[model samples]
Target: METQDSHVNSDETKDPGAATYGNFINYYTFNPPENRLGLIPEALLENLGLDSGDEPVLMLDVGCNSGDLSVALYKHLLGKNASGSKLHLLGFDLDQDLILRAEASNPFPRNIQFIPLDITDDAESQICLSSYLEKHKRSRFHLCTCFAVTMWVHLNHGDTGFKSLLARLASLSDYLLLEAQPWKCYRSAARRLRKLGRSDFDHFKALEIRGDMAAHAGQHLEKHCSMELMQSFGNTSWDRSLLLFRRR
Candidate 1:
């Protein structure tokens, strides 16, 4: 599938810090039926065993864009259990405008809320996020899923970012779902683009030198064979397996 070639400066447009809000606006307007946000929320709720009547779980849709994922989760809960149980779904993004738009849409259930968070710095970000989890200990999250967000870490911090993100997700979830584009796609695209003189591959390599090499470059770089490893994750050995890890 051909993706839009964004002319905006990657440094500005792809800023991990900017994810606090809606970054997709830079690419597309907010419209329905075509967006994939609904799929994630439904899948997450099913995976987490969250249903109606129970106290809402503390769901964190990291890299939530325009709150579609959050809406999807709520919709799933509403559909499964019309008992009107409250849901405490918090979405974090870098852009305030996106947050406002999400609020304006008001797609959340009465119990849901959205917040702005900068995930670029793990140490500080975790301290804050963990605090919320602590206060809401009664509502242990059944699920924590980061969709299309790992690319930011892999692009900026390379494997280090990936590991840090994994550690955090492990702390907050009973089940987790993480997805990423194959590194080779980025590498191949960069090579092809450079050959055609469209853009310098150096920009892509700066984020990741050997792997996808499209996003992360400055920090130490290496390929971890993640796409291969994550493919065999779940008990049944499904390709895109949902890793069910109990809290240790």
Candidate 2:
């Protein structure tokens, strides 16, 4: 669970979390790095057989708010790396403030990097991500993790936008670790907006893709994105499933 001090500090500035509102500025305060780390299997990345052939193994953390989880995951993988392959992790968030904080607090400056990016902007995201890949002489990241980030895309961008996110990540990654927010979470998010006296998310009610959100994403990845489910790391404390997929 999140540290009491962190949670208290976050609550001091917490937003209503509406779609129109920016993301929870200090998200890891409520959903701590340890809680997120507990659900992941040991040596998960190493087990994926990621052999970069002398180059450092590259990983991407999507929606990497505040970089706590990204930092934790990098250390976890680095410590247990039996093959002694150098590891480089890149974490990005749409929130420039969050990314700035991530960069400021980052411990492993050489191995981990944080940048601000809005993944839904196809051209911008593609160009930025492609540039990173090109710099490292890598076609795609060895692993990509998108935890508890789908709802915002779905609620704000509609069904089509949701699918597009999954498809794009799959294209950029050899393996994907996704934690899509469930349907009830969507209702709760919508309700929170209502409670805050904010207008409803425009794309919420019209979304054709509803119910079992993780499954819907999985199906789309396999059927439309040429990816296959590899395994499940089980559910997080928030009752969100952590699923792993690989490009076919």
Candidate 3:
């Protein structure tokens, strides 16, 4: 796969121009961990069948920022002693600053290994992933969670980037808990912002995973982002999930 090695600083401050509605996600428009906008760690563990003590399993938080989700995963797994499994959690991010902050915070289990990496940058992400896996080759992750991340890429790299990311992720985990912003929501936000003359960003386009990466994996894909699905998940639910192609 072709990879972009150019060290693109993803720091929101580095490029004010990039922070357009195209780059600025409503979810991350405010304090992140404090807001808990992405309750991904919990939902992912639930899907992974993590019950106390099942032998320390390998867990990866793809876009871990300040280790909030990493900490949540650790706390949740620790709460469960189902099989007495030890957890070897790995958190990766494109921002070195966040990785440093996560390391300094030390919020998760002592076993967690936080690394500076970016998924869009294939060489680094793959190397970091491979090295971490080899170091703890005993177990593979039972589940992986990627939430509110694809849209950011779609904004940056277009549909092709989103599809590539999904394919790459599918190759890495048995099951995935993906939480993406429905296109309607993005569109609504865009129109509102435009009407207010708040921003000069492109109109949000409708995108769905079912016909995209989900089809590629050939797994039963279900969308629960609609009103009914949202209700089931809850009004306070800040995220929605799609059980992506299952690894049979």
Candidate 4:
């Protein structure tokens, strides 16, 4: 693992245009957490069996940019825990500088943790995520929330990688609340890189999976991952769909 000094010192942390995998350094400045929070209803979370379990409730936040939404969601759920069940949330992203900011501003450091991890790294992710599960005496998280991350993974790794990500997320949690970026967003990201004079995403042009990515994700999770779509919480400001799935 790179030290804080080494991670934050990188040029990528200082410049958003340099980011390769859509992990923008200053992500929340343009898209505030409050806007995203407004779309999620409290009733949607209460129906997920989180508060019903006798054991501790665990939530995983993938691509938690600066941990703002993770902290907000944690506080939201904190109010729903009428059973007095202990709740813990683990948020991770590939950007280390963002993780540093998250850690610094964290008011509930004991229950909410932010780490720098690349979920695409199979061995490392398994070890790190599994270790967190082990410490809580659990095998999988109760719920996993991934907001607007699928496009970057798909554009970078191609069609196969996108399928693998869906399978992996399904295996890690009983419920997955996903917000997949639409096809237009992919085009936008690619165009941004080109405008910045950076090389295009390698797999973007070659990707076989195209159009209605959220629906595609839902199909893959249902057919290949033994998961079924439980609900669709509708689209966000960017027109991305928040689809919730449950392991069958």
Candidate 5:
């Protein structure tokens, strides 16, 4: 419900780009205004096959750092469909501290729940997400948004790891909104990995020159998972793209 600026002191936090590694709160506080992020809920709602009056829409936010964007999106959806559509939002992150902060700060606790989850881990993701879906009587997630998480998986697990992560994400959700970072930003990710003393840092470089990184990744997703890109939004400042995909 509250804007990210209202929740944290942006002036006090250092620029996210300058930090070698930082927590979710640091990133949320200092990151530039991402107006495109707010467009996700509307996009999902428009494409959701269910009628507005039929059933509650289920949405998932993967790697939902500090829950700022998730909460804002929840409010936006509620505002658009006041009487007809009910939304149940679930936000997952690997950071327990961030989840705790999200719970503490959430204004609409009844409408949303934040859980510490590693969606890339097979057993953990299956057990946790399956249980939740079972409880809700849902077959698949109506919409899933993953922002700036691919690079982390790639840097840690390499190309194979990233694709596996994408496959899992695609399997869980009917529609996916992904933010893909360009190859130029690979150096920064490598630096972050190095700061953490990672021995596998060279993996990122190997994956860098695939050519028009976002398109290359999208092609891979299309071929492997049958996901087709619906629309794309460019963020020139960051050399990143926000892509919306539908499972084919």
Candidate 6:
């Protein structure tokens, strides 16, 4: 199998365009341990029946900023099972700087790769992901993790936009780990928009994304995509819930 290195060593100058997204490096470096979004690789291994180890486990981490969480998951997986089982982690992020930083900081260069691509763009996402899969000779993703990303899409593109993204994700992985933000967060974002003299509820009004944003997303996934919620974990400090879903 052919492996492509997507890491680029650029001058550590911050791009002005990326300022609106906040400081990615500081966020990852200063992220609280309590808020760490850790994935249970053993649970995934047992659930997928890959415990005996037939082939390498292919995992995707969407919106993986700075790749800290991806590294943690990879380490946990290897720590739990040091047998013949192999883990291949692919992390995708829209920020080029974050991708660069992730690649630079990654200790296990061969086991993990970071790609800079906007998953919201269907054609671009498909092409980039498909090319990677083809290069690696993988059929489908065994597990996929999406954290702290859907709410942004929901705020910017509305409910339909978020659902479309979810559908695309479903096609890529059999098991999904999603973090759902509540309506309060959306309202808080609206408040920020109002402060900036921008219309706050336009997307919400258009998509009817009112009341319990988290529940709305969960319901949509269950009804439209036939995804069953296996388990849910909550972080009261962040006011978010991590939901585990399996295709039915």
RMSD of each: 7.9, 4.4, 7.3, 3.5, 5.1, 6.0
Point to the candidate with the largest lDDT: 2
How much lDDT does candidate 6 score? 0.68
Model 6 ranges off by over 4 Å? 1-23, 37-42, 80-85, 193-205
Q: How far in Å is the alpha carbon of 111 misplaced in model 2?
A: 1.0
What's the TM-score of each model vs. the native? 0.62, 0.90, 0.63, 0.89, 0.82, 0.80
**TM-score of candidate 6 to 2 decimals:** 0.80
Candidate 4 on 19-102: residue-level lDDT in tens? 567665556766667666776776555677566656778899998978888888777666645333377889998878878889
Give each model's whole-structure lDDT. 0.49, 0.80, 0.51, 0.79, 0.69, 0.68
* Candidate 2: worst-modelled 10 consecutive residues by lDDT: 1-10
Prediction 4 TM-score vs. true: 0.89
Q: Model 2: per-residue lDDT, tens digit, 92-202?
A: 887777778899998888878898888888999899999999989999998999987788888888988999899899999999999988899888878877876768988
Q: Residue 138, candidate 3: how far off, in angstroms?
A: 5.9
What is the per-residue lDDT of model 3 for residues 30-122, given as tens digits with 9 covering 90 to 100? 434423433333444455465456555676777775676567556664565422346667777666666776798774446777887768777
Q: Which candidate is the best by TM-score?
A: 2
Model 3 TM-score, 2 decimals: 0.63
Give the CA lDDT, 0 to 100, for residue 132 in model 5: 85
lDDT of 1 by residue, 64-149 (tens): 65676567656665675533455567677666666666677765446666666667666676777777777777434566656556
Query: By the lDDT metric, which is better: model 3 or model 6?
Result: 6
**Residues 1-248, candidate 5, lDDT per residue (tens digit)?**
11122233342244342222224366665553346554444545755564366676788988787888788777665665543346788998877777888899987776688998776678998999988888889878888887777766675567887888889878888888788666655666455445545453547567643457678668877999889998775553565788888889
Model 5 has an lDDT value of 0.69
Which residue pairs does candidate 4 place in steric collision?
none
User: What total of clashing residue pairs does each candidate reach?
Assistant: 15, 0, 14, 0, 0, 0
Best of the two (2, 3) by lDDT: 2
